[model samples]
Each structure stands twice: as structure tokens, then as C-alpha cells.
Target: MGPTREQFIQYAPAALAVAAAAAGPWSAIAAGAAGAGAWAISVSAPALRSLIACGITATGCGIAAHQVLASGMNPLFALGLAVPAGAAALAHHRNLAGELLPALPATTTAAAGAGQSSQAQVITAYWMEFISGPTQTEGRKLIQAGAVLAHLGLDVGDEHMSFTGIITLPQGQQVRVKPADIASVYGIPASQVEMGDPKHYAPNALPVTVHLRKAPEQPQIAAGIPTTVEELWAAHVAIPDGAMPGTALTLTRYDGPLDWEGIATRERKAIGAVNLQDLAGNLDLSSIQIALAPTDKPSQMGVRVMKEHALMHGTMLSDVVDELAMDSRGYVRLGTYIDANAALVPLAQPGSGARHLYLVGGSRSGKSGILEQILLSAHKSRIAVILASPQAGTIAGAGLAAHCGDGLDEAMGALRLAYAVMLDREARYRTPRFPFTDPLIEFILDEAHMLLLASSQYHLEAKAIVEQLTRRSLKRGIGVVLATQTPLAEDLGNSTVIRSQLLIGGGAVFLRCAKGQGSLVGTNAVEGAEGIDLSMIPPQWPGQYAKIADRDMSGLDTEAAARPEDGTFGLGYLLTPGSQAVQFRSLHLDVAPVSLAGSLPPVAVEDCEAWRHREAIMRTPMVDQRGKNLIGSLADLLTKAEQGPPSAAQQGQPAGPQQAQAHPASSAGSAGGDARELLKPRILELLRSGSSPMTAETIARKLGTSVKHVRPRLSELKGRDEVINENTLWRAA
Candidate 1:
């Protein structure tokens, strides 16, 4: 098919000679000689064809230059000879067909649209083959392909490449079909067809790809297997020990049942439960150890399903009052007991002794919640409540008989009034002619320790108030609830006599604390309060107490005080009279605005008017002669019974050495008169700064004094015409 190497060698020299002759005879002869040598080298060593060609061109030029110089001709003419030699060598080269073989036409190009259609046809064929097979192997491969494509932001579509196709069951055979037939092929009515991705999908839907949802299998719970509680319940597996029924359980890889992780409540039941539709069946659970759910850890028992209640969650304090038909004049409702079904359980009796209650808890431990509950319940029962606190703002909007400021004088004033009421009741009880018909008055003192243990002149008065209230208030139908954070004996100061009264006939709730103050509530507060694990308490359950003194106790000995109990903080225990302790969750109330802007919000409206009327009558002084004489006599007796000598102010004389030393208030004022004067200026500054008149309470708070003490000074300033007392507010004159 081609010329041989020898043929190229033979033609090379003669061709070069003829070409060189055009330049000159000397060039022709010199080129011919060069061509001859090139042919010899190429013929002997075929691999050196390129080298020989180059060498020959250079040799020819050299020889031609010599020949031209001898003949006086140009050397450039010799270059033309090398061109002919190169042509002859190329003519014999036979590898051209090999070089052109790769370029031969193997296929033809189509138009852009036709080419796209062809590609789509191939892809469709491949995808159809993957999904249409009866075996799961092909189906799995198809699913895998879909997953891969989906991850790449693309999905397998129908013939039109719009909606994705569905693998459906037709005539009991698994078949890959387009989405259009999904409604009809599955016997679904056309009118009932839903939008894309409905709950009822094609038989072989995409949801089946997940391992848990692959197919229904024989249910088995294995320990340490990490199965869901829904799976265990669905299988009807026997609940392991240390776990309660109606609770969700998960199986680990080992053989024990653990609480399902992330499952806060147990709403899922067996197949026929009414709430089956709403069960969260997909959560993974862990193994639990005790019958009771632990609070600290992720225990499934932490959740309680809420059941519908008929009235006020059926556990409002007012409900208890109605059920017992308690006499409003002598009874006030406390909190109700909640049963397992979330139904309210009526207490043993309506007015469980109507004794005083001692509420103790740490910060944010639902103390205020309980207090609000008591106050609102009393209001609903048509009983008046008298609230006292250091911060008047704390009860600023509370609708009550009276709200006493935290100041010692105000607190003393309220106490004195309560003692007077107690005396009136005592006199009535003693007298056969008069019938006692006053509605129960509840005196709630918040932060009692601060009031009783003050290092000021009012401390003795505070002590007196406590002793008198404890001894006579109960008989007078005056209920008292003293609340504090630290209930230590030392905190109670000289008023420790109240502790015995609190233990004898009162109720106490000792919330979660590191250690129990045994002397405070006596042994009844935390008796048999053992086996409580503090490790189980969580931060969110702050009001959890270890023990609660129920209204009635049958087997308990009132004489034996409870031991100093220690347990996790905030886990509450309910101790009923004669019954075993019941663990309970703290009551959660609706959030009320902690502000004092507009109308006071009342708790319940049904019986509020009756309660308001009764409270109004009691606060009004009696106009009858007997009432006036009794009130005057009592005031005289109280005023004359004072043991300590009057201070210099009472005597209307400058403080003598003994008088100054006797009265702590006078001593403090003498020691810090400059500081007291500073407070006056600060008070004036606040009054001048405000656009509106400021209440005495607000000015007292700014000056860090009790409103009772500040009101007298404010009066002095008013008398001097430096300020004006408008309503209950003070403003610059």
C-alpha cells in the first residue's frame, strides 16, 4: 500500500541535484553530495531519519557556500535543494493511513432537540428497569438511585419530567406506575383525592425506605437494642419491673426496658386506645430503674396526660368550700388534692381545724403561688384577707381588706388591729348574750422572719404580735399563714414560741431543701420522709417538696416532732393524716401581671360582693354605745399595759441618756442623723423630679424606710406647707 524505504533513498539524491541546479551548478553538485550522504545514513539507520535530514541540509549549505565562493554564486540558493529532498522522503512515508484511522466517521450528529429526547429515553428505560421488577432488589436499587439524585437536588420524574412517579400495588402485584393512576388504581374515590404527599400514599411509597418503617415485623423488645416505646407497646410486650404500666418503655440492645428518650409524656397506648391517632410513636427511649419516674434524669414518668375537668380544673380552693358547705364565718378553703386521673379529690372535711399554716420554700418555689391561691380562695368563700409584706408593691393590686406596708410601724398597726379583733371575739365567746358572726379574717404575713427579727425598736412589738396571734387568733376565727425562706429557729429570734403553735394544730409544707429545720414544723412536717432521692430532681421543678402536712393525720403522733430530714431540693411530699405520704407535682397557676396600674383584678366573681360587704362592715367602727366603750376600753388597756418606759418623743422632751439608749429607733436616728437628713433631701428630689404626685409608699421605698415611719415625717413636711398630701399622694407645695 506504500513505497519502501529503499525507494525513498534512491530518489532523494537525484531529486536534490535537480532542485539545486536551479540555483547554480556548484550548488547542484554540492547538494547532490549532501543528498547522497543523507540517503546512506537513512538507509543504514532508519531510526535516525529526522537527524539525517537535518544534517544533510546543513552539510549542503556548507558545501554550497564553498562551491559558490569558488564560483562567485549566492549560498542562499542551496536551501531550495533541501526542500525537494524533504518532499521525496515524505512520499515514501507509509504511516498516513494509521494516523487518519482514528478520524474516520463512526456516528452521525443529531439536532439539539432530537438529541435531548434520545437521552431522556435512555434514562427512562434505565429507571423503569430498576423499579418495575417484582423483587425488592431492583426496588431497593431504584430507591438508592432516587436518594442519590435527591441529594444532588434532582428527583426522578414521570414521562413528562414534571411530577415524580409512584411505585404502587395494582391487582396485588407491585408495579411501578405513573402518579396519575395512584387514586384509581388504589380504589380511592376521585373526589377524595388529596394533594401531593398525603398520609395515604401508594403501597410502595417513599416512606418505606426508613429502616423502622420498612415493613411490619414480629414485635420483639431486646435490651440495649434502642427501640422506641411505641414499638414496645405495639408488640404488647410485658412491662419490666421497676416501671409502671401506662408508661412508655423502650428496649435497649440488652433485654431490659428503658424510658424512651425525648418522650416527655406517656400518651401512646395499645392499638385500641382513643388517643391512638395522636401518639408520638417515633421517639427512641432508654431503660428506667424505679417504678416511679425519676425527675432529674430523662424519665418518661415526668409527663402526665391532662384529662378534662368540669369546674376550675375541679381543684380550685372554692370547689372544696362548696363541696363541704363550710360556714363562711369560720372556714376558708385551702388547696385541693389531685388524683391520678387528674380529678380533684375532696379533702377529709371542709374546715380541717381552720388552723394556721406555715409555708416555707426557697426562691421561686411556688410560695407566692400558694399564697395567691389562699387569698383568692378566701375571697371566693366570702372571707376577708389581710396581706402584709415589706414591699407594698408586691400586693399593690391585690383586692383585700387591707395591705400593710413592710415597715415595722405598719406591720405593728395591722397586728394591733388583729389582736383587737381577737379580743372582741374572745369577749363574745365569753359572753352568753352576744353571738359571734364575723366572717373569718385571714392574716397572711409574707417574709415573717424579717419582720420578727429586726434589730430595731419594733422587734419587741413584732414578738408581741406573734405571741398574741398564736395564742388567741385561732379561737377568734383569725387564720394566719406565716411564710418565709429560712425557717431556722435562730431566724425566728425571741418569737420561737410560735413554733410550738405551728406544730400543734397547724399545717406545713417543707419544700426541697438541703436539710430540714426540725424545730420549725416539728416531726410531722417530714416524718417517714425517707428514701427520697435528691439526684432525681431537675432545675425546672423548683417547687418540689419532700413532705406536705395534709389537713388530717390519723396515725401520726402530734407530740413527736419530725426528725431533721434531708433530701433533694424541690421534690414535694404530701402527708395526709393517718395515710401514707403521696408524692405530687406542684400546682401551676396562670400568670398574673405583677404591676399596679389600673383596676385591681379579683380572683372569682360569683361570691366577691358578699365577701366585700362582710369585710366593709368589720372595718367600720360600731356606732352603738357598747361597741364604742369596748373599743375605748381595749385601746386603754393595751396602751396602759406597756412595760418599757416612753421614749423622749412620747414624753415631749429631749432624749435623756437612758431614754436615748432604751429606744433603738432613737439611738439609730441619733447615730445617723446626718444620714437621715440626707434621706429627706433625696425624698424632696424624687418629688420634684416626678411630674405626678408620688404615694407615701413610693417615697418610703426611695428613702429605704418603712411607709409607717415615713408617713409621720411626710405629715410633718405637710404641716410645714413644704408638701401637699393629695389623696394618698404627696407633692411639692
Candidate 2:
């Protein structure tokens, strides 16, 4: 049941008694149950009950103050009551005024053929539009006096004039005028303006458009027209010298809810394929501001544009190369090349000519990605791949011809086997009439500089073997690709081999690198290809490379790199003999997740038959005739050395596998020590000495052991937390 006056009186006796004591009975009832007080009394809900309680309390206080005043008590009591009552009355009047104001009338959109005189009628008619009742009367007065045009400074122009000022509204709310908002008042498009702190307006005068419209002459009616109309109109038209009055004015509805989705769609299309920075002057943030109410302005908002960079997607290898799409033999698809036309170009034939490839890039620079692509494509082509990496069988372990497991000895062995193959090829080359039949032999080395470092004991031998292979391997259908983080001459023993390999045919694939370092590679490899601006190489463009081919060798003109400059990492340049570098992205196998070297399809026995044929000859068993001959010769030499005085009789004979193998007992002891006991103490010593973390190679060198031997122990130590492996270098835990 709804609350009643009698029920309210029963519940609030004190409030009733106080009110009755100060005023008469009728006055008491009216004061206690009128407006909010009456509404609160009639409601039955808990919230309404609470409001009633507060009203009763306030009423009682008012009654008590009235009684005190009548009794001639201190004036402070009257003042106390007056302050709160006055505030409430003023707030109520303000709210009432806002509610009574009528909204602006909806009108037809202005037509292009609408005469210039119609502009004035449109503006005058717009004066009748009011979002609030209280503002309506004021708007009428302003219009009658012609002060609306004057206040807006109408000049009727193609461009908006701007102004900045703080104005106190009739309701006493101070609003900071925005230049863009002022331009809208004159029916012109606005430029962007910074709306700083809400508390303070900008000091500089803002620019805004002030458009004017000529109206028909009419007799002034006393009730409708004000005395200031002529004066205001005259003041509105006064223009500064040399400033032409703006004509071509268009009226756009100013106060309404914004269409955000439409704005976003339009902007996205306007931006096109250009970068976000390209929209500097063309698009203004204010034009797209979301204003829900008439008073809500762009001055009270902030804007942020989410930008997206050009990230090309992966292209398929088969799609890019015709050979791969067909027979796909003897070609390892690296990546698609981004050609001068910005088209997908494929690298069909790798290791073209004897000049091997040098894949130079920094850590995580998509170097590994490129390597993986090469290996997978090479396998598809039935090319024999020999991998010498720190990790064994990284992408596909079992199908590989050989995996140099994380062992320095194993790595050296792989290279030695390659050298042996080179020797065999040289011998076969002696027969002039031999059939030109042989699978292309690829010696792919990962982290090759470790073996060529000056600190490495076998640097001289390794360098000699690589140089010899680079010079003669191509004719023998052999190719070598060396990938390293550092491809500098110092790291490679000297520039002689690297230079020859690069200049051989297709130049190097230079990934993200320092200007000086990349330039060094270009100049050394491609003649006149110097001063390559590394800045043009996007830092974030992973796997993107600057490839200079034979065509670009003579002249430093790489203007034909590719449009949009950057492409998918697998897309790159392929420089081969007799043709310009083609831009293409590598074809990826249609799998759940494409891997460069890893996750390859199983290698069929038939597919690897060529590799098997070559490997059998290279890996001759020790029990065979060749192995037996070496063993007999080795045994005889050892016996003679033992019988002799054991003086140092080995000057040119560098320490090699054959020499070590001759003395079986000594070799076993040395190998066992290196692989097990000897490396442990050396590692502990290095850590205890407070030396910086060292890589396996550095530790091996210090301990006179192979890197292969130290890595396993390092792994064990790392697991035990006795040592820490930071990016491959080890330190005390």
C-alpha cells in the first residue's frame, strides 16, 4: 500500500510537531508533504522511505530555526537556514530551465542550387532551434538583434577563420570555445585543434570560418526586431584590409550523435596502402570526433590513431619457381625474391657457379629462417646437404646424410669429409672424357667462423681447405654455403676466400646489419657496390635482405630492389650469372606450421639415392683396401718413430686426425680425456677465476680440448645449476 499523510505524520511526530509549532496546521502539512517531501512521503519503497526520513529531518530543523528567529535568537540561525534553502532553490530553477528549452527544428538539407540569399534564411531559421528551453528565449533575442551573425563574425568564406576565447554562458557555466567548433558555426570544414587541459583554454586566438548570407529587406516589427539589429549587421560585415569575404559557404548540421563506425570505415579507405604518417594534412581528428550531445565538443576529447605496418605474407615455393613446380631437382628454393616490380621472384638454382654463398646477419635477424628454407628446398631437389651446425639434426635429424652433433670434433670431421670429397672430385676431373654426372655436393656450415678464428689451433688448416674448395669445387659440381653472425674478414682468417665466394656469381644476402659491416661485404664481393645505406634497410624488416647480383656488380645501381621496400622474410633477391637479381618469396610447404629446416616431410630412400652413392665412396670402411693400406702405413711410421730417438721430426706435419689415429693408444687417451675428465677442471677454474662467461669454443681453446667435448659437460653443469648458460656462454651459477 502507498504511504499516506496520516501515516507519515505518525512515523515523523517530531517533524510535524516542530512544523506546527512554527506555522499553522495547514502550513505544517504543506511544508512537510510538498514537492520532493510529498513524493517521498507517498512512496512505499525503502529508498523512498529513506528520502522521507531525510526530508522530515530537514523540515524539523527549518521549523526549529523559525522558532528561534521569532524568539529573537542570534541572527546566525537565520543565515544557516537561508544558505541551504537558497542553494536548493537556485539548483531547482536551473534544472527546470534546462528541461523547458525546446530542441532546434529539423530542416531539409540545403541544396546546391539554393541561392546565396537562401543562406541567410537558413541561418535565421536555425536561430529558432534550441536544445534547452532556457536557451530558447535568449536565442530569440540574439537573433532579433542580429547579434548571432556578429557574435559568430560572419565573413562567408571558402576557408574558416579561427578564434579562441572563454565565454560565461547565461547559466554561469564557463565554456572554452574551440576553433573547430567555431568553424562549424559558420558552416565550414575545420582543421584539427589541440584541446589541452579542461581547466584552462588556449591563449592563442583560434582560427574559424565566418560565413554571411544576404537576406530580403523587411519592415521591422517592434515585438520581433531589436534596435541593435542594424548596428550588429554593420559590425558583422566589417572586414580587415586585403581579406576577401568568404563565399561558397555550406551548412552542415552541427549538433547530433556521431556515426563512429561510418567514420572509421571512411578513414580506413582514405588511408589506402599508404603509411599512417601520410595522413598528416589530409584527415583531421576533429572531423571524426564522437559527440553525443550538443554541448559535447571536440575540445573535451582526445584522439589516437592505431597504425599498422606493411607486413607481407609468406609466398609458396612451388608458386614462385617453375622448376620447383615441375621436376624440382638440383635446386634448393631459398626464398621468393622481391623484384623491381614488387612481384614474387623465386630463387630456382642455389650455389650457382663455384662461388659459394655467405649468409651474414645478426642474432634473430631471420638468418636461421633463411637457412631452414634452403635446407628444406635443397632436400626437395635431391641435393646432397652436409650440415655442420652446433645442433645435430636441428630440422630433420634422421633423413640428413650427416649430423655434426654439438661437437667440435664432429664439425671438423664433416669439413674433413667435404675436403676428401673435393680431393676425389679433383682426381675425377683428370679424366677428360668422363660423363658429366654427379649430384651437386653442398657443404653447409653453421657458425663457421668458430673454426676460422685466429685463436683456433686449426684455423690455418680449415682456411686452406675452404679456399681450395672455393677455387675448384664448382667445376666438380660442389658448392659451399657458410652462415655466421660475423662474416668479417678477421673472423674468416682473411677476406680472400669470402671475397672470391661472393664475387663468384650471386652476391651475398645481407640481412639487418651495421652500415659499415654490410658495406664491407658489398664492396669486397660486388665491384663498385659500395656506400650501401644501411638505413634504407628497415630495422624491423626481419628476413628482408639487400641482395646484389651479377647485373648489379658493375654499377652501384640497386634502384631495382623492390617497391614497398620490405616483403616477407622469405622473400628476397637471387643473384645468379647472366641475369639480373629476381625478387621472390620462398615457397613454404602446405603444413600446419611451415618450418625452414625443421618439420620437413620424410625423406624417401629413392630420393636420397644420389646422396647415398656419394657418401659410400667418401665414408670408406677402415677394413676396406684403402683403409687397410692407411692402417699399415700408419703402423709402420709409428714403429719407426718409436724406434728412433723420438726427437721432434714433424715440422710441416700439422696435428690432424690421420696423425692422431696412427697412435691408437695415445689417440684414445687424448680423446677420452677431452670428452670426460680434462674439461671439468678447466671449466671450474675459468669460473672460479671470476672470468666473464665464455662460449664452448673459448673454453675448449683454454683447456686444449675440442668444443664438442666441452659442450656435453657444460650441459650437465648447467642442469645442476653449477654453471649458467647465457645465450650459449657459460658462467658460474
Candidate 3:
């Protein structure tokens, strides 16, 4: 449209003044004054560059006027500089940002907009700016700071008019913009901002469809109802301010699906900006699981939420044990998932070969607790158990094993015997032996890595035997389950191939892995299990746990208060809920773990295929704690067996052994006195090498002997001023 008559009349004065400037010195002075007045009247909030140009042109005119009138210089030459500078101001005036701004509206309109909520104000401001021109400058500052949204048409009504616009998202560009900027710049609050993923993109810029829905008047979370982070954000929860320091989370709903991801990626920091207590109406969030799980609306991708994670409070083995089905079972309940799902691991697959349980953890990773659960579950299921552990469940009670041994020699002997049994079963019955719910024999090494260490003289042989059992013992009636803190390639027997085979039958359990050897998480052990971020879990549960140092006896160690050290236990990742898994806490032993031991008869070297392969293997006898496989005499054991309990005199024996065995060293005439005296040096060497006091049972494991041998020898050593007994721990004097 043509210019309005009023606008033309207003512009005539400036035009006349410009024409007269070429006529005379007075005309030039008038032109400069008129131009400055026009600049003041036309531009509002002009950029510094345009303002400088205007100021310079006006000042240059003043100098020209001063020189012409006072010194009589020619007007054309004097005003030459002023003329070019005025042209530069006109050029900038056409492209000025202030020129795009609208004239101030009526008082009523301003008042109406002022009273509108922040959402309305931002939306209106957006459409107003966008209709004028693109908001970007040569610096790209607008786009980088996410201020370009001001030029993207926005409309906010009730739920119907959410902020919708096509935003520019550059390729490979991370959104470093914060939500608070959105609030401060556009009058939208940080909590109301929600961004959708960028899909299609232009050649120059990626176009992201952004929607800022109206945040609810007051935030609301479904009470006792599970919800996805996406759904909650869709409902207008406090948005995660990732730009803020210390608030970034590795795993987010936008990054990938949370259900399949490991539970180690906690989303607590997702909505961490808001007070969680206010959000959930609760103070304790330790037990609350904020992970993604399937809610009622499975098709819509709802979430699974659990208050007081089933494992955080933790359940006991007895709580989940089915007494009726204990006779022959395949799966052992390690713990409960955060979503209340059972953490089940296969000990023996129905059609496949018997699976070995390869459990690994750093210090305080609850490896021992998991091993104890396997022992108790094996016993309850009436399966034969061959155990080799350093402490050998000394405090927990090793009564549940058919054959119990300790140290490298004992572990080697146990593995060979179990392998022998597996081979014998194959030899006797060439037909495939189906797994579990049948007579199963298991060899459990609590700290098997100790036996497979590269520094150990028996490393090669032990690794060979373990690899053989892991590879060839498939479909046999026996299996192996071992726990260790060191599961490096060197620590694992024969590397990943052998370890992979061992885990083929049953999946592995991974707790807090040791630092500096992150490669362990990439091995067969971690591959078999889903990828989990161990860093998400704290050093320990850091929730409710049994307070330590309950008793401070005169001779007891009181310095050690909380969990052995600053090591993690109980909480860990487990394969669960079908193919996907969740973080769970291994069951706590409310009652004495010894009671979970089984009554399976010993699988001695004499009874295994190992004896058939090398009859000399029988040189290492099964030191059965139950007195059933004694080399010398069974008369006294038989008498005690009928009594159904070990007398106080025989309390040093490992518990839960089937078919009694009289202690050879305790016997009257069978080199009994000589054996007790001979064990003293071994016990002393084990104690002398240690820094802290150990129990008699620990000394026995280091010496490959029973606690009975260790107790008498330790007492004798104390008498000789060679060792000291501090309640349960024995130390060198």
C-alpha cells in the first residue's frame, strides 16, 4: 500500500531539509538538526551500531557547520564527510532491529496482556516477533542461546493451545540451553519446558518440533501409581535442569528406553530440581525405585514404579522358598527386583547342560552372601554339594555341604571330584542326563579366583581342571558355582571362552566391579548379563542395615563398625523379569544361614569319575564334617549321627554334612595326637602373614584343614605365646 497522507506530510520536513543542505551552510546545519530529530523519533531501542552511525553523522554536520561559518570553508567540501556518513545511517536504518518492533499498543491492550499468565505473554510475544522477521543475527547468538524460539510462532491457550513451533536444531549440536533461560526470556517457567526429539532436518539446519504445553496449576503425581518420566513430564512435572551443574543424569527417557536398560542408571536426578519429599509426600527415597517399568497401559509405554523397592527393605530366602518343591529345583532365588520381580538364576536348565553360577564382586559386593544362598538352596533342594571356600562359611556354618574343603589344594580336589562325578555319570549312562529335579551334584568355590591366580604354583593345573569342567561337563549331572572379587581375564580360568561356557548354562551375577579393570565388564561375564551402570549404585545400599558394633566385649574388636569396609553389598544387578533384568538386593539371612544346609551324601573322590581316571586322586580324601566318609572309623560317628546333632565336643566340625565322619585327629590311636601337633606351624604361618586377627575357621582354610585341627593348635599356640585369641579372631603374638 502507498504511504498514508499523514506519514507523507511528516516525512516532507526531513526531505526538504536534506535538499536545502546542498544549497547553503545554514541549510546543511538545518539538515543535521532535522536528521538527528528524525532519528530520535523513528528508532526505539536501536542497536549500538546504528546509534553510533546516527551520532557520528550528526556530529560530523556540526563540525562542517563550525568550519564553514567561522573559517569560510567551501560548504561542499566541509559537508562532504557529513553527506557520506548520513548515507551510511540511512543504510543501517532500513535493516535496524528496532524498526521491526511494533508501535506501543493502547493502554487497555497493554493491561490485558500484562494480566495474562506467563504462558500467554510468551506466546503472544513469540507470534509478534516471528511475523516481523527471523530473530537470528550474524553471530548466531540467538540460536545458540535458544532465543530463536522468540521468532517461532507460539500459541498457548488451555490444553488446546500449547506452545508449538518448528525450531532449528543443527546437526551434532547438543542443547546446552537451560530451561531457566526460557522462563526469564519468554515468561515461561523452567518446569513447563518440554522438548520433542528432532526428526526431519533442512540442508542448513535440523528442524525440531517443539511443544511447550501449559504446566498444571499445581504439580500432581499419581498416588501409588506408576508413571513414566515422559508421561510425568507430559503432565507437567518439574523439568530436569541439565544445564545446572551436578544435575545431569547419564540415562534419560529421551536417550533410550528405560525398561531394557540396566537399573544402575537411576533417574532420581531426572526431576531432581523439585523437592522429592514434596513430590512423593515421603521423606525416604532410598527404597523408592524411579526406573522405567511397564505400567497398566503397556501399549502406551507406561512405567513401573515401586515405593520402598522390594529389595531395599530386602526379603529373606525363607520368604520365597517353596518347601514342597525344594526336593529338586533348578532356579535359585538370589533376591527381589526393585519392581518386586524375583531375581532367578538357573542352576541347571531343563534341556541344556547343568549351568554353573559364576558370581563376581569387588570387596563388599555380597559375593559371599550369594554363595551362601546357593548352598542353602542346594541343600533345601536335596542336591549333593561339594564346597571349597577360604572361610568356608565358618561364621555362617558350612554344615550344608556333603564334602567341605578350603584353600587351593582343597578347591582343586573338590573340582576334580565333581568333574569325576560328572564323567562317571556320563560313563555309566551314555544317555543325556537331564538337568535339575534329578540327583545333582554341585561344586561351589566361594573365592575360586584365589585358586586360579597367576602367582599360584597350582594356577595352570587348577585353570585346566576348571576349564575342562566348564566345557566338557555340559549335560552332566554336576555343575560348578564359584564367587570371587577378582574376575579379570587372568583370574578367569583360560580367559573368556572358558568363562563363556561356564556361564552358558546359568547367567552370571555382577556386583560392584573393581576399578582400573573396566575390561572385566566387557568380558563374557558382563556380556551374558545386560549392560548395567555400576556407578549408579552407591558404595553400598546406604539405606537401613543392621547397625554394627552391637557388642563391645573386653577382648572384642570395636574399631570395625559398619560393613567390613566401605564396600558395597546386598544391592546389585541380577537377570530377572524374563530377558530384561533389574537391580536387586540379595536376600538377607534373618535366621542362621547354617539351617539352610542340605542332607545330601558326600560325592567323595572314591565315588567320582576322578577316582576312575586317576585312582591316585584318592590320596586326597573327602574330609566330610558329618563323619560319613571317615578313613579310619565310623562307629562313634554312627552313634552321633543317630543323635541328630553334633555334641559340644565336636562343634568345631563343619555343619550339615550327610553320613557322619569321625575326626581322624580326634581319634584315640590313629595318629590323632600327632596330627593336632603337626597343624600348629601351618596355623601360625597363616596368622603371621595376616595383618588382622582371623577366626580359627579362616586359619583352617589357609592350612587346608578342619576347624578342629585349627582350634586345638591355636589354643596350644596361645599357650606357647605364639598366637592370641580375641573372641572369634586368632592372631600371631
**Residues 348-422, model 1: lDDT tens digits:** 123332467766666644566666655655554455566667545454325544444445456555555565555
**How would the candidate models be sorted by lDDT, starting from the highest?**
3, 2, 1
Worst 10 residues of 3 by lDDT: 629-638
lDDT of 2 by residue, 1-733 (tens): 8765534433443344344435632444545464365465454343344434444444655666677777899968755764443443344334322222222235523232234333344443443232111233432422122112213222332222232222223321223355354344444434332333432332222232332222233766667433332222122311221111111111133221221211111211221111111122222222112111111221211112212112255554434444332132233445543321223112223334333676766553456666665555555555566677644544333244443424455666566556555544543444323223556656777777777777765576567666656665666556777776544676677747555664463345545445455443343443322222222334443333333221355567656643333443433334443332332344443331133234545333222222234343223221212112121111222233334422334432556887555534334335665547655665877766743455575665456555677788888877888898654546787
Model 2's number of clashes is 41
lDDT of 3: 0.50
Instruction: Please report how far candidate 2 places residue 1 from its true position, in Å.
Output: 71
In model 1, the runs with Cα more than 4 Å from the true position are: 1-353, 431-435, 454-457, 494-496, 512-525, 528-537, 541-571, 574-581, 591-636, 641-645, 648-733
Better of 1 and 2 by TM-score: 2
Q: What are the per-residue Cα lDDT tens digits for candidate 3 across 240-306? A: 3221122212222232222222211223332111222132322123312444342332122222334
| Maximum-TM-score candidate | 3
RMSD (CA, angstroms), candidate 1: 31.3
